[model samples]
Target: MHWESRHERAPAVTVLAVGAYTVDFYIFGDRLPSVGETVAATGTASAHGGKAANVAVAAARLGGRARFIGAVGGDQEGAEALATLTRDGVDVSACPRTDPPTARSFICLDSRGQQYIMTWAGAADGLTADVAAAGAALLRPGAVLVLQGEIPVAVSAAAAAAAVPGVTVVLNPSPVEPFTQPRSDPDAARLLARADLVVLNAAECRRLIGERAGSTPSGLSAEAAQLRRQIRTATVVVTVGAQGALVIREGSEMHVPAPEVKVVDTTGAGDGFVGALAAGIAAGMPLAEAVLLACRAAAVSVTRQFCIPSYPRASELSHAPLSPRQC
Candidate 1:
């Protein structure tokens, strides 16, 4: 669906990111350690991560007013996560601190900047539908609700259901299995129905399409078409890293190609795309234009290292003229 003008104007477009937060430990080496073996690394570092947290920070960096809703622990990691998001100008007032320790991820990046990650849910698992709905309550008509699969599926569904009509719900089911798996729960079925837009990588699109269509799609274009039909109401965006993204909406498709950039780290690149996409929508950019900018943002992200730190600012994107658009 297109962005129709609301009857009355709102102060500013807000982006509410609902999901997980974690402290990411990055171990950099020439190559990943072998099974049951230890390898020396060239370097290492730690930063704030988690799909939702990375998205929020990316949006904030891209000049969008962002709000974060998720659970953190009463630990040092939690404190650091809050501080990091706050420093980036994201609103975290609605996020609650729980008894469980904060979630954490250990990432190993090779010289090529490809990442392998392991996570501990900690307090993130404590995110309930009630907490997510509470955060959704803060959204007004012109707001955007960003959801991810890192937290409970119920919580994400709750946030989507609670959003107002004029508010856009963007779902990025990263670690995509939870929602794509066969759902016995009815609410799980409605998750895609409630989303205004759904972002998926190649593999995610394949699984979702395979499950919904009862057969594997023949190819990328076919998968996009089938997925569009399945999620009839919401726009479907299939992101093909490096090559660009395919946007399928209302029987029409747009291929938004990303500019070529030197790759550094692909970690959180999808989050960067979703964040910028939400930011663009919140800023009143047309959906097609938003996807274009989002693709550019993601391309820029991979040229850097780490997660949130790798996201490019809006100004950075503006400085370099983007490559041509392929429809």
Candidate 2:
């Protein structure tokens, strides 16, 4: 089904995104240069991008009320980041600029549409529990708190905890790493328990499972099941690029297929998926239906270039040529 953004002037739900903010430099070249090799970039562009920023912009473009709670550097990039969010109709009052330079990502894309990104956390690493708590206050019963792994784990945990009982907490653990928090840390426990849904890609799922297992395991299906069991309180959705995603919830599991699309630059596809998914769920769409809409949005994202620019507006999705893939 082709779902369009039907949000009214007064949106029924709000999306509060807590994570990183960065200025992205996209360098397109014929190929990746080897050590000591100099290959001139064929093209280049700069944009405001970071997982949280991208998600916020995407949510807003899809007609959701998006509020961002993150940190930016005290430099020009920070100013630009805030301006971009404002232009996208996202609320940025909760985001603060810090002493350090704003985060930056140098994305290298080749002719084949593959991307390699090097990101500097910079001010994004400065997110603290106090800052997160202030943002959490905005959460209401039906609000959505979207968290990503780009910021300090403690901050993500705090934001999750701030969600009231009826609020839906969605955690996207991209750039996932081993749990450094001691097993006894109650904050970590709360982080896992509070998430109503956890969205992650296949590699993140494997790495998280590996961290818990003390070693890397084999088989995607088995590992996915293990991840679901480990994060027992939340429904797990593992995305496999092109093939789509695996959704595990309430003692059942199934696959959702994504429409095939030619890739250009995959900078913000996952963020687009997560953001649209949050918007759909906040609009009261069922989990499975939301995933389908998210997958469609993501497929549209990879066919374009850059980050926020690649995200499809609600009207664009309505007119997209690709038919919905069978769920």
Candidate 3:
């Protein structure tokens, strides 16, 4: 089937997400306990996590046809992950099952809304090239393909490349360790070149490119510029939590400041931003407008706790506050 026809049959915006699906255990309240130290958590909850799954939920919540492509273990957590994705309106028809147990993350949120997380790759690491190939037909032209660091680098790269000449691949290189150079993996530079849009946090951008001139308050324009110089992709977005986001496209740049909110947890704010951005892009919004929409979505995400559960749907986002057209 032709790519466009597939999208037409679905919805106005279709997103093919390739990455991991993890179950997250969130411990809400103050700081994490020290060794042998006991602390009472104000609340505890479990929800779906993993970069791709979060982004898939973000896209779906924002009124897009979001399809997740990854592997889950045959374990109970995997089943829960699948159920969570389905509940979020994500199409899991392309997801597979394995025997390695599903990926999972343990996240702790402090009173300040900062989070510390540890994750186990589990079945996520087993996502191979063959699996991605099986879902290649789902890459509809003009659709958005959201990728991240949760999957194998080769698999992520192949999915990104395959989207070319078909879907628009938006890569969020999270965790940032997989792309480290002189390392035991494929060349990240080559894979990045194939991405239609690259999204990362301030630290990830600095890791990919060296430190550049810019203070925390002025935003990471200098570092963002350096990354733009190093990357071949047309768009590079550097997400700075609370401070907002920066976008560099075709020699032009735009900064979208984040709206102030009572942050409860920031675990999935970045994913929400990327998902919203992809949704806007898939909906044919200009990069600048898309960045603004994404900024709004992310701002809303921080107001709630956890990852996937915190993401706002399109209707909620429509009512959220947005930054004015000034950086």
**lDDT values of the candidates?**
0.81, 0.78, 0.78
List, residue by residue over 1-327, the lDDT tens digit for candidate 1.
456443244534378899999888999998887789899989889877899998898888877778888899999888988998999888888788999999989999998877789888899988889888877876777677899888878888888888777788898867777766535656656777888888988788888766553443346777877877776656888898888998877768888999988888888899999998887777667788889899999999999888889988877887332111110
- The regions of model 2 sitting more than 4 angstroms off are 1-13, 33-40, 178-186, 211-218, 319-327
As for TM-score, the candidate ahead, 1 or 2, is 1
102-204: candidate 2 lDDT, tens digit per residue: 9989999998788788889999988788888778765765567898878877888987876676667888876765242426666656676677888988777
lDDT of 3 by residue, 215-279 (tens): 46364777677777677677788988887888877677788888888887889899999988877
Q: What is the lDDT of residue 109 in candidate 3?
A: 85
Say which candidate scores most in TM-score: 1
Per-candidate clashes come to 0, 1, 0
Rank order (by lDDT, best first): 1, 2, 3
Who wins the lDDT comparison?
A: 1
Note the residue pairs that clash in candidate 3.
none
Ten-residue stretch with the least lDDT total in model 3? 318-327
Candidate 1 local lDDT, residue 17 = 93
